[model samples]
Target: MQPVLRQLPAGALLFHRNAPAYGIFRLVTGRVRLERVTPDGTTVPVHTVRPGELFAEASLFSSCYHCDARVVHDAELHFYPRTALVARFRGDPNALFDFAAGLARRVQGLRTRLEVRQVRAAAERLLLFLRLQVDAGRFYRPEGTWKDVAEEIGLTHEALYRALAKLEATGRIERLRGAVRVLRTRPG
Candidate 1:
């Protein structure tokens, strides 16, 4: 089945928590965030879906969404119908394996993020995050604002700013327009 192409503006609500599950989405461009609202009315960010990534895969089997999906940036996306995908998977073991592999990679990334958040120092946490995310050339391009990154790393915005400044001052990292280039692997 052909996926439906959609364009959504920032702040658009794609789905809500406990809503009937539709299918999965592939982000061709822009960012989407999955959040869970607590009983006390606190919205906790569960995950940020970036371009070239898929979200709501679990919805294929579940009756309802566990979190709300909101478009954080102007987005281009493709929605794959759940019934179609399920039928495809049932007929093709290789397709199922490929999808499972993608999920495993996401799991690994989450583990790395959890490890970064566990670091005590803001600078150290930032460094570790960069180390894990940077490419072979030692450059990391942030998908969202520094504030978003700060929250992801379990630091306040002010602390993240200070950490960035410290890293730059110590010649550990160089800040580019939308990226950070790591100069040293170990903090000096």
Candidate 2:
């Protein structure tokens, strides 16, 4: 199947909530943010799609998008037709297995996020998120801003700041310009 390429500028809306589910997309370059916006304009980020990852897979069976997808940076993507891909999966068991594995991983990620949200203490939640990042090979001496980190970890900016301050005071983390380094962590 020939994939359609789309180039979007930063901040462009690729798909909005309740919009038609055209196809699944693979981010070829740059970043995309998938979020659910409340009626009053509050945005709750669901996931961030990076290069080589697929998004909108749930749309394969659904008629409409459950959330909005917006380009966070200038991005290029390839869209695979939903029906054709579904047909291919039906024809190839190995392809279906691989697709199921990918979906499972996405589900596991959501489960972990849910667990993080359940942690009562802000510090523990932050630590758990950092440890998870480290385990995923996504943490490298922390190049992301604290605000971005907070958002990704589902913490309010103020709460994250307070947690960071406490962690720093306890010698658990060291903050640097545009980055945070985890020194050590212990159960609180």
Candidate 3:
């Protein structure tokens, strides 16, 4: 395990777009928000991180920040220096596999998001996103987004509502106003 150098309180933006390369973050406590900004400078909440999750480690390989990381709740995190992490990652073959696996997951996650955006039926895309979230054990409401659900799932709000009704009718999932709860885990 990496050493924790500091504890940042809630609402802290760990790294702004041009911030220094701080290696990988090993989250030991609380949550982090990964936000995507639009061309008009509108900040959209894309993902919420929880304890035992790693973020920004991809930056270790490239020595650059890709997205803004903000703390959603108070958190204790390791602030590994980029040089050290890179050296260790290169030296250990096993570690390299783990790193590669992680990067693959990140890539797959992005691909899923894009697929959700391109899907023709709102119900199908919404069903897929909920299954992915449930698989990750993440609940979306606390992150302050359900609207982003409609937007990112590439559905009009009315379409998302209609899809929810459809899913509920089939007993595939249950929809609360701010959240979706899985009735059964879909096979991977």
Highest lDDT: which candidate? 1
Error of 1 at 127 (Å): 1.9
Q: How would the candidate models be sorted by TM-score, starting from the highest?
A: 1, 2, 3
Candidate 3 lDDT at 70 equals 89
lDDT of 3: 0.76
**Which stretches of model 3 miss by more than 4 angstroms?**
34-52, 64-68, 129-164, 168-188
- Summarize candidate 2's per-residue lDDT along 1-188 as a digit string, tens digits: 57899999999999999988878999999999999999998999998997888889999889999999999999999999888998998999899999899899989998998888888799878877777766432333544467767776788999998988887788766777645667754559
Per-structure clash totals for the candidates: 0, 0, 0
Candidate 1: worst-modelled 10 consecutive residues by lDDT: 133-142
Q: After superposition on all CA atoms, what RMSD does each candidate show versus the true structure?
A: 4.2, 5.0, 7.0
> Model 3 Cα RMSD, Å?
7.0
Error of 3 at 145 (Å): 14
TM-score of every model versus the real structure: 0.70, 0.65, 0.57
lDDT (CA) per prediction = 0.89, 0.85, 0.76
